[model samples]
Target: MTETHEIGMVYLAASDLELADAADDVRGLPVVTQLGHRLGEVEDLIIDPVERRARLLSVVSGGILGLGVTERLVPVEAITRVDDRVHVDRPEPAGDGDGRHRGDPADLAEEGYQPELVDRPPFAEVYERYGVMPFWTAGYVVPYFLRR
Candidate 1:
C-alpha cells in the first residue's frame, strides 16, 4: 500500500479521539487573515485526544458541489485572534502551493509526544504530507479565550 494510505490508516487507528465530532465546536466560523483575507471557513478542529484541546484548524477553501474542496490544516499557534471570526496569521514561506502552512516535525519532539511514536516511520511523514501540526507540539490557550 502507498505511504499516504498508511498514514491515513494511522489516523484511523487512533482509538481515543479527543472530542467526538470536534467539528461541531468550530463549524461555520469564518477564518480570515490579519488583512481580512477570507481564508475559508473552519470545517473542523483536530483535537489531541489526550490534551482535550485543538491541535490543528482544518480550513476548507475553494470548493463547489463537493468537487474541488480542499482541507488545509493550520497550527493553532498561527491563530492570532479569535472572536466573531477565527483570525490566523499568514503562513510561512514554506507552505505548499495550495497556501496551506507546513508545520515543523521537530516541534513534535518538543511537545512530549511518545518518543517511540515520534521516532517511528510515517508519523512525521504523515503530518508533513497533510501539512498539519501535532496537537501535542504546543500549548493551546484559544479555548479559554473564546466566549464559551
Candidate 2:
C-alpha cells in the first residue's frame, strides 16, 4: 500500500497501441483471465518514463451509454502476459466492507517507492469537490465482462 506521484501517460487517442518501436498496442484490447474470461477493455496505459516501462493500465469497467463508467488501475506486475490480449491472474475477492472499490497507491509507483499507500485527504477532497471518486477508491480488483 505504498503511494507515489510519479508522472504517467494516458493514451486515449487510439483504440490500440501504436508505438513505432514494437511496443504492444493494448489500447481497446480486452483484458482477460488465464481461464479465458473477459474483464474489460484497456482504456489507457500509465507509463513511467524513468523506469522506461509501463507501470499501470487504466481499465474501464461497467457503464451504460458512456455513463457511470468506472476506471480501475491495474499494476503491470499483475499482468502475466500480453499476447493477443492482456492476461492476468485472477484477483482475490474485494472485501474491505467499505462498499467501494480501491487499489494500492504503491502499485502506482514505478520503483524506489514501496513504503505504504497513504491516504491523501487533499485528493479525496478534490474528488469530492468534483463529484468523482479517486481511481484507487473506485476498485482494486478487475471485474468480469461478457464479450459481445
The stretch of ten residues in a row with the least summed lDDT in candidate 1 is: 1-10
Kindly list the per-residue Cα lDDT of model 1 for residues 6-90, writing each as its tens digit.
2232221233444444432665798887788887887655445444455555576775444455456555556667777987665
Write model 2 residue lDDT over 3-55, tens digit each, in one string: 23433333323213333323644778888866887767786655434433444
**How much lDDT does each candidate structure score?**
0.49, 0.47
Best model number under TM-score = 1
Task: Give the number of colliding residue pairs in candidate 1.
Answer: 0
For candidate 1, give the lDDT of residue 124.
44
Models 1 onward score TM values of 0.53, 0.50
lDDT agreement of model 1 with the native: 0.49
What's the lDDT for residue 134 in model 1? 41
Q: For all candidates, what are the clash counts?
A: 0, 9
